[model samples]
Target: MNVSIPTLEQFREESRAGRLAGRVRLQLPCNLTDFPAEIFSLADSLEILDLSGNALSRLPDRLPELRKLKILFCSDNHFTELPRVLGQCKNLSMIGFRNNRITHIAPEALPPLLRWLILTGNQLSALPSELGHRPYLQKLMVAGNRLQALPQELSLCKNLELLRIAANRFDVLPEVLFKLPRLSWLSYSGNPFCSHNEQTALADTPVKQIPWSSLSLQQKLGEGASGVIYQAVWQSVTPIPVAVKLFKGELTSDGLPISEMAACMRAGIHPNLIKVLGKIGDHPEGVNGLVMSLVDASYRNLAGPPSFASCTRDVYDDDLRLSFSEMLSIVSGIAGVAQQVHANGIMHGDLYAHNILLGQNGDALLGDFGAACFKPTAAAHSHALEKIEVRAFGYLLEELLERYEGEATAGATFATLTHLTALRDACLHIDPTQRPVFTEVVARIRTA
Candidate 1:
């Protein structure tokens, strides 16, 4: 309602002097100067308070005075860590500290009643072990961080229903996570381990052994605009894992013979992509279903909030992040595999994170050639499209690394940005005559 500091201060002073307001929602102007510490004066009646977007560094010393506070919004601040006194706010329910420099989340720093904790777009490499100890933390958003792995302690939170840990450096997810019986919904895209391609396998890929009737289908993993993924599994399986994806849909094209979708999937084979272990031919339950490798995971959309601590309220399960090096390694590997794909004259039109697979070893595979158009003269066309694809790689790299100027290295957060940008700018020079070929990218990655 357009409140100035003076107005808010008057309430705080009056309240401390013993007055009351039903509830309070303060919106600190994004560029405001001094923070109104007086807001904490109402220790008894205040239930919900928002002090987002101000130049405040440390929280007000008297914040514990807001004994009645339930939800707090102290996002977009300069705090390195949350104040320990906040734990005293026994009535707190939800809190957001997005877009800050917070790198640590101690065990006892939070209230027991917290259910929604959002912390996206921060410098968190791994979640603190203490964080898993939260009693009522039902929803957690720790998306875009430098995490290399997940903690086993997370399974201890029996009430945790949804987990969003996308855009981290994880290659092998903790197997213990699936033990949480209440964990029904999860999104772990952008992780180096969650493979993107769930179709086709290299020559001689192992056929997955399955006891069909024992498996119960929970729900379908919508494979986005490219393919279809599923969440079905055999009963009594430890960790209750599910099949990651399946193929066998739409078979006809303009004026083309009806080979049937099942025939089309069974024809191709690649080691990196999901292998169709077995097929249930034309069953009444579904059409020509092909059994594929199980990822024990699900796909998530990247159109929601950042997964950092501050992004709690602003983000959803869909919002995920992708780092530069991870993206580059993924793209480079995909390009290498595409060399094999080009042998067959195919192009994976949608070559983004949504279509790439991060294998258990952090290797990436190209998949989802749905939009692919056949190029009979693919060998000649590769020359023209190689640089074009490289430029696309650069754009994706920018999104992966949040910076525009830095090499992709262990310390460089924005690794591919500066490296690829320089090459792309040269390749896409106004005088098309100046672009470097795809060989440069291969050479760079090899040396890096």
Candidate 2:
């Protein structure tokens, strides 16, 4: 599935020779300071254009010539402002300006059909109120910015499903966020409102400190926005094998690495959650890390990350099917873990199926704290935060039911489906106050 990238010279030569006429995608990143005029040769068919990792400050005014361009990425650039001409690209639905120097976005900078917008790691202090006018907008990632508040107009984005406003200057949680009906995933840690509580919780949590000298690193298991996980051997009395997550020491779309580490440490232990053994100490590179129990090889991710079309929802294999029991077990395990996490005053902000792992017998393990945050101290605010996550769990249940292969009109299966449907509706109640807490959700599942 890997398409070979063309070198700058090759691309130039192909375009000059009229050989790139029908190409649908183009990725040329060679430190160019200006948009390649040659790209215009494929204007008739190009749908995706990636100009990331470049030194350009502005895109060509004729960018709208590519009438078919649906996605555009201009990350890691020196753009001081979003190009105003992008609004002319009527077909553009997704735009990424991550890790850019953009400090301003004109009211007309966004395209009409925009659905997903990524402006993470920018210096913006405010956003255009025009953002709320985009009826198709679903995912908005503005983490690591300097914004003090979100425009109340954004509450009109009724279809917004995922949002990341972490590491901002907000003094309080935005009241408008509670009004979004489809906000299933959210991460707002590292802000002034709840930072003190996070530090206090981290200090109160007790954990062992494992030194780097006693560990031998092995192959890399996986990498997330905050850290790289590796399969390492802990040179303890018995030389145990464990997974070590080394923090990247940078701001991610979710938030700071330190926040994620604190949340993981505070999570403690749960039967259906990944076991954190201890924290890493005296690293050779002075990197922050955690030591966790290595998960079994038989366990695999239950689903893939969200795709362009799926927006905020996880993408499952089209042919994958699950029996009624298997689906129920996965849901039950996640519900139990969520109940325990909430009781500890933590919100697993990114509680989608992609963060869950499933074993051969349908046993589930919920991992990844990159988007988690501590709850507010106020009782009402804390309850509302848990309910926001309840909506995420409700989406998880909805996704599983779509692939359920069991009969819905027969005996126990029929009754179970009906009960689960009602529970999902309750969890997804538009009124956050009306939604049941994880404790109630777990009880209902157990009885069903």
Candidate 3:
């Protein structure tokens, strides 16, 4: 949450240095119309350059001079097109231009070694096939765009693990997308593929609707890309403290807030899932909200979100290690929740470690339905979609194994770990049909 924004004075000081010990990071927020020419002086060692929150329209043509530059952030800028000079940066791997007016991306604008690319909230309707050439590309975020279809060549990005193509105009799911080997996390909601009637059908369901006037908002608990969560006390005959999520009520990178609310309501109650108390109604600001049980303070995020280097995969602290039993308990709980949610004709599209909460004893609760989608149970592809999420679970299991690092291998523990490894492999098979369903996964883990 805390971003370090450098000042012009710091860059001047580094410029004064004879380039031997020049600063490697130059982050400035000054509003300007052009790139500073002096920045090229430290091109030898510059690694990260943040020119976000500026009025720049294009980058300098000689950007490739920065031989060591790796990360570039130019979000919240004025631009009608992505600067083609970006593709010339040999060492650049990460490019972020979120919340821009970019509508066109030149065919040569994508760096060859690109690993993580973020172009959220843009006006792009199409992308060039050159994007498919980036062999190392992993995380691609293009949500909130005007895209109607994805470039078929993008399927060549075999390493892509996480993708966000939601809030677009696509009429159907891209078949090539399902062929990716490492696609574990995805969000394609709010497109033509989603039906508004799925939520309209629940209009008269037997669920309580709590008015906003009867609740007293308290301290904030957490927040995500979709909404902000706060602690609140619902005043009834007997007052009760609960968690309230007041949505921003805007089209997020995933989808509309209403769709998320419908998915949460449909999820209902499960032991390993957050219990929805009711829906907030009659708000003063007309903001959409939800009421849910307040989780205990002991619960913490299981792992951190993906980093720039580990794109599309969760990152964990080196010291964080769970016991064999604890890891099994957490995985089993999540698998059970997956089975229950899929049974209710719902797909938890954004299943990742960061969205999971873990108690001290490693009991897991799956939360966050922003990327969830409601699918018809009789739909032909419903089963296939469920298998795709099983791949996400396999990815989580792999991350847990990496964190453990074979440090807790006792007699029985080692045997259990071996079985878990096989299970993960089976779930991560290249062909979706080869993967076992959540019900089978739960049964296998229970017997192990």
Candidate 4:
């Protein structure tokens, strides 16, 4: 049956006739100007309505009246603002708008009933405060936007489960995002601040225990070549929630399974790295697990590199300064950390903005260690570490400089450039053998 969905009105008329009740899926023109108002009133059993792949500008004004509408797909459009009519739909659970021209959203735009909201690939510079007021928001996918900062109101979301805020224009991510009690999954991949693989592991990963009354969870934080992380709480301690990482793929690159994961648990310690507090033996229910200190924060999806959707010119950060001195400070802070990794004989494979996590006290922690691999005893690992580290650091410096001096030039600042340019160039050198050692680069940065 070629159920031709002519205009929205025709679709509604057919829908009102009841034959289109369970089989109603409409594809509107890319230049569609509005939506069918009568279809919702008659289709008491309507469940899914996909209005994507269109040139629509705004959501239908009468959507709230559709008490039975469940899922709405409104991606690929020219909507500059969030439709106020959306706030009226109390039964609506999911809404998607991945590719659109939306720039700003009013604070109270979404109804408190929304559970899922997808706004990736949009022009939003920031989220509205009303987004947090939603009592049941479960998954928030705002990965590719102009967002430079997250609204402080997100902490109020008691039921937020998964959030992905990857590939954006943020240099620093706020720590408050971790305060939410129900949040468990997050990825913040491409910001300049990430470094350690977003999740850490141990020979034994501890799962924090929480009381049933406290909205606790038993979840898999995810696994890696290093280990698997789980969320749990202490049974005896009551409501003490934490993440437990159990080491796996233990065989070192040398081909011998690492016993050091256990040895290091006994010997190692660091504020930045997860602590290994010994093993809990094998679980009666299944595999062995470990106990460790739980860090206070949630996951952020902020990875990959700068894409076309990465920059947001209209999205401004008040702290932004184009001065070389300021740029130097930023570089200095990052370089200072690189110096430490070099000391520990550890090289951060992915040292970009997204991996960098700024602490509440104004310090930075390199998050996301997915590409972080142990340098083997082989010559290839040692011979090339210097250049690899330099390239990563240099790349970060370049991004900062470009962002700071948007449309401006390094002209007349030759003195400053002259001082750090050699080091920068050395870091960016194609031939790893030509780059300066980490210590040497640090000395030059301080001297400059």
Q: Which predicted model would earn the best lDDT?
A: 2
Model 1 TM-score, 2 decimals: 0.42
TM, every model: 0.42, 0.97, 0.92, 0.42
lDDT of 4 by residue, 419-441 (tens): 67677777766555676767787
TM-score of 2: 0.97
Candidates in order: C-alpha RMSD to true structure: 20.3, 1.5, 2.6, 18.3
lDDT string, candidate 3, 333-370, tens digits: 99999999888878888899988999977799999898
Ranking by lDDT: 2, 3, 4, 1
Scored by TM-score, the top model is 2
Residue 54, model 3: lDDT of 87
Winner of 2 and 4 under TM-score? 2
lDDT of each: 0.51, 0.90, 0.83, 0.57
What would the TM-score be for candidate 4 when compared with the true structure? 0.42
Candidate 1, residue 76: CA error in Å?
A: 2.2
Candidate 2 per-residue lDDT over residues 17-85, each given as its tens digit: 877778887787778898988888878899888888889899999999999999999999999998999
lDDT for each residue of candidate 1 in 160-221, tens digit (9 for 90 to 100): 64455545577755455444534423444444543232222221224443455655676786
